[model samples]
Target: MTKRSFDQFFKNPRHWREDLVAVGGDFSVDRLLYAYTHGIFPWSEDPIRWYCLDPRAIFDIHRVHFSKTVLRKVRQKKFRISFNEAFPIVMQACSYREKDNTWITPGFIDGYLELHKKGWAHSVEVWNAENVLVGGVYGVAIGKFFAGESMFSFESDAGKIGLFHLFAKLKESNFELFDTQQLNHVTWQLGAYEIPKLSYLDRLERAIKDMVPWVIPLSHD
Candidate 1:
């Protein structure tokens, strides 16, 4: 679909708020869930205008590209990948890595924390040999849908490692889709694509229908 057409569909907010409660106030859990299911989400910093974009970017698990460089890094196993071990830390790192204020406001973080407690949000962490939290990614996982939020890295290729490992495991676990929300050059290089907003909503609906419990093991090698 053309970019203009994709941008048009996300313009409506008739049913955005549950009962006319302004969405820009805070990132409530209910609103987060509604936004995800409807192909809209909170992002921008202005609370008064809370941003949601169109032509959403996503990756089909089977389509993720692993380059030779990434493959070599994975094979070397220089860092360890663990799931849910340092969720809050990962989120904080992603937020603060640039040394700037972030879109994942305190409200968003708290809301996601609740989602994690309920098994909806998940985090994949990367640790160096010293077991230091070098990089990671976190997002909401509803059934076959994994809505990637953000990632950060302190060491070279650390973020990529987390991403590749996450995709690899999700594929092994039979995940159907990985939604990156909006694609950038980096994500596009990693095989994410933009789809018609309506198509995205349809896929999201189908995915969330058969909710799969993401079982994260407690130990790692």
Candidate 2:
């Protein structure tokens, strides 16, 4: 495989078959840099395929839909949410235990840890009444854009709660965009839609120009 510059990313051919078929494959720094900067991400395991779909789904902070059911649950105060309190454990749980497959390999973890230390990554964690972690989500923040990675839940509705909390907090703090990468039934139900890949990159470019601090002081109770 040939390496390419960030500017040459869109021109490079995407051959998933060869690019990520090997076990324990690591995305080169340049490749990963290109991926995120271009609104694409590696989301598969085994033969990890790089994905960049047009009409990508994202949640505009002002437009994030919060279901009344979820809001009612949040008001009930049954669970607690915390931010940046348990980064590694939350990420590991999101990968290893809840998801039968994982692309967040050791290398990915270490790389993201470096990102976290650089203040480009963050975590939002949820815990049950017993103060046991039940769900969480993690992602990288580039300027005002947050590229969501993955979330996992160990209890009923925990993941949704975590997402709701994160959404509300981010919106309240005036973030411009929350990139979900890809959308599924749950995300679609909770209000996620797609935009063209090129359009998505344009949005990312604009979003990443704002140096607003991702200042979401999540409540920990």
> CA lDDT of each candidate?
0.74, 0.72
Which 10 successive residues of model 1 have the least lDDT summed?
14-23
How many residue pairs clash per model? Answer: 0, 6
lDDT of 1: 0.74
TM-score of 2: 0.79
Candidate 1 Cα deviation (angstroms), residue 87 = 0.3
Write one digit per residue (lDDT tens) for candidate 1, span 1-221. 33443334344433343312233544556556655655566765355233334566889888788778878988998898888888888888888835568787776777788878778788999999999989899988877788899989898878889988788777766777678877788899989998866577677888888765577534445
Q: Please name the candidate that would achieve the greatest TM-score relative to the true structure.
A: 1
RMSD of each: 6.5, 4.3
lDDT of 1 at 198: 59
